[model samples]
Target: MSVIIDFFDETNEVKEEQIEMIQGLINLTAQMEEVDEAEMSITFVTNERIQELNHQYRGKDQPTDVISFAMEDMGEGEVEIIGEESARLLGDIVISIPRTKEQAEEYGHSFARELGFLSVHGFLHLLGYDHMTEEDEKVMFKKQKEILHAYGLER
Candidate 1:
C-alpha cells in the first residue's frame, strides 16, 4: 500500500515534529484501512484562512481545527479513474495551525498530539467516517483514539 501525503504550509509556524507526525499518522491510517495506492493533501493554514473555508463550506463563521473534502462517494465495485494509475484520490485535509496551538494549550497537551489528532480525524473523514450521529461519533472517535494510541501519540 502506498499513501502519498502532500503538505502545504501556509502558516509557517508548523513544526518539523508536526510534519513527521502527520506523515506517520497518514501511513498508519492507510494501513489500518487497507487503502492501497492513495493520495491526499494536507494544508496548514492560519486561523483566518481556515475560518473563511469553514464559513464557505460548512456555513460556520468560525475557525475550525480541521476540514476534509472527500474526492468521491464510492460504493462496492465503484472506482474512480485518475489518469492510468488507478490511484484512489482520498481528498484534502485543511488544518488551522493557530487553532491547533490554542487547543493544545487549552487541553493541556503537546502541540504534536493535537496536530496528530486533527490529521487522523481528517483522514478518517476522507475514508467516509462521520461524527454527526451518536453511534457514528462513537465509532469514529474510538478508531481515532486507537490509531493515535498505537502510534504512541496518546492524550
Candidate 2:
C-alpha cells in the first residue's frame, strides 16, 4: 500500500513525533482498507482558523478537533484503484492543534494518543465512515479503535 500524506502545518504546533505517528496511522488505515495507492492532505491549524472553517463549512462557530473532506463517494468496504503510479486523491483532513491539546488534557491521555485518534477519525471519514446514528457510531468508532490499537496508539 502506498499512501502519500502531504502535511501542511499552518499552526506550527505539530511535533515531529506526531507527524510520524499520523503517517503511520494513515498508512495502516490504507493498508487495512486495501487502498493500494492513495493520497491525502492533513493540515494543522490554530483554533481560530479551525473555528472559521467550522463555521464556514459545518455552520458551527466553535473549533472542532478535526474535519475531513473526502473526494470520492465510495461505498462501504469498497476501494477503488486509479492506476499503478498514480494515486487517488482521498481529500483533506484539517485539525485544530489547540483543540487537540485541550482534548488530550481533558481526556487524560497522551498527546500522541489523542493525535492518533483524531487522525484515524478523519481518515475513517474520508473512507466513507460516519457516526451520525447509533449504529453508524458503533461501526465507525469500533473501526477507529481497532486501527489505533493496531498502530499501538491506545488510550
Candidate 3:
C-alpha cells in the first residue's frame, strides 16, 4: 500500500512536529483502510479561506474545522473504473488552523492530537466515510480514533 500525501500549510502557523504528525496520521489512515497506491492533498488554511469554501461548496456561512472534497464522489449509478496499476486520486482536505486551536483547547487535547484527528477525519471522508447518520458517525469516528491511536496521536 502506497499513500502519497501532498501537504500545504497556507497558515504558516503549524509547527514542524505538527506537520510530521499530520503526515503520519494520513499514511496510517490509508494503511489501516487497506488503500493501495492513493494520492491525497491536505491544505492547512485560515478560517476565512475555509469559510469561503464552506459557503461556496456546502452553502454555509461559518468556518468549518475540516472540509473534504472527494475525487470519486459519484452520484447514483455512476461508477468509476480504474486499473490495478492506476493510483486513486483522492481529493482535497482543507483544515482551519484557528478552529483547530480552539478545538484542541476545548477538547483538552494536545494541538497535535486535534490536528491528527482532523487529518484522519478528512482522509476517511475521502474514502467515502461520512457522519450524516448516527450509525455512519459511529463507524467513521471509530475509524478515525483507531487510526489516530495507532499513529500515537491519541488524546
Each candidate structure's TM-score, on Cα atoms with residue i matched to residue i, is 0.92, 0.90, 0.92
- lDDT digits (tens) for residues 1-116 of candidate 2: 88899999998778898898899999999888898889999999998999999999889989899999898876689898676667788899999888888999999998888989
Better of 1 and 2 by TM-score: 1
Against the hidden true structure, what lDDT does model 3 obtain?
Answer: 0.88
* Best candidate according to lDDT: 1
Give me the displacement of residue 61 in model 3, in angstroms.
Answer: 0.5
Q: Model 1, 6-35: lDDT tens per residue?
A: 999997888787798789888998899899
lDDT of 1 at 63: 94
The segments of candidate 3 whose C-alpha lies over 4 angstroms from its true place after superposition are 75-84
Estimate every model's Cα lDDT from 0 to 1. Answer: 0.91, 0.90, 0.88
Error of 2 at 68 (Å): 0.5
Per-residue error (Å), model 1, residue 81: 5.7
Ten residues in sequence with the least summed lDDT for candidate 2: 80-89
lDDT of 3 by residue, 45-139 (tens): 99999999999999999999999999989868978877777789999999999999999999999888888888888889999999999999999
| Clashing residue pairs found in predicted model 3 | none
